[model samples]
Target: MATSEKQVMVVGFDDHEHSAYALEWTLKHFFAPFTSNPPFKLVIVHAKPSPPSVAIPEASEILRYTEADLKKIAARVAESVEEICRNKLENEAIVEVMQGDPRNVLCDAVEKHQASVLVVGCHGYGAIKRAVIGSVSDYCAHHAHCSIMIVKKPKTKH
Candidate 1:
């Protein structure tokens, strides 16, 4: 009764400095004294790109390369990444790897997990360039089902 309920905050992570910055930013801002709760739990989510449509020419007749096969490989990679991240992060988190368009994949994860917040990082693209090329953070900001936090600062290593 004293501690209140805990919600889930889905954080988009790709094992890079930008994404790491977002995670750290959220932790610093939401959690206090580096060890307090923020009314939510951090859930690390990564959207693995869909497998190329190229078929295994030799195995096409029997067992052809399918999206599921590629997903299996991607899952392994995601698992490895999750292990490293979990070991490095100070707070507890959950890891989820999904497939398809990154924008839709991330949004879907938010809805599926019923997350209360989606923390993402700005890719540092200029407005003109972002308008032309598009940005994942932009897409998430517009489409995420929950509250979105876009960390714009670059990671600084001292």
Candidate 2:
């Protein structure tokens, strides 16, 4: 089947264990049976913070350093994602690194790809922390224009 003809599944990813576990779980449950051709095309989306814009002479140097650091982080994220999906998927997963809040970036990716499902990892934050930091999964669940799946990492027994 043609790549464009297949349904798209957008997975929100980052350098976090929660997201990694979500991707692993997704593959094991949804894509394991069909090694040759999965039902949906996987697209991993990573959202990086936009660099601050300041109008100070000294800030330019800082901006340059920050931009370089961000680039390194993006590269590391792409490598990690590739490694995670290397053996699990027959078709290479599309990786997108966008600048913005994760909630907005993920929803935008879903729209851009015309995805049928949006998968995100739950941070399992408490009410206070969620209110303060803002839960990306919660925001996507409410705002995204498709089915949303928030995967929670299973608690390990000590």
Please write out the lDDT profile of model 1 over residues 1-158, one tens digit for every residue: 13476788888876466776776677667764446445677777877777555466775544445666767766765676566555555566777787787788889988988888888877798899999988888898888878888888754699
Candidate 2 lDDT, tens digit per residue, 12-43?
99999999999988988878888888888899
CA lDDT of each candidate?
0.74, 0.91
TM-score of each: 0.72, 0.94
Candidate 2 segments whose C-alpha is farther than 4 A from its true place = 1-4
Error of 2 at 38 (Å): 0.7
User: Residue 14 of candidate 2: its Cα lDDT?
Assistant: 93
Candidate 1: residue 13 lDDT (0-100): 73
Give the distance in Å from residue 131's predicted Cα in candidate 2 to where it truly belongs: 0.3
Q: After superposition, how far is residue 21 of candidate 1 from its true place, in Å?
A: 1.4
Worst 10 residues of 2 by lDDT: 1-10
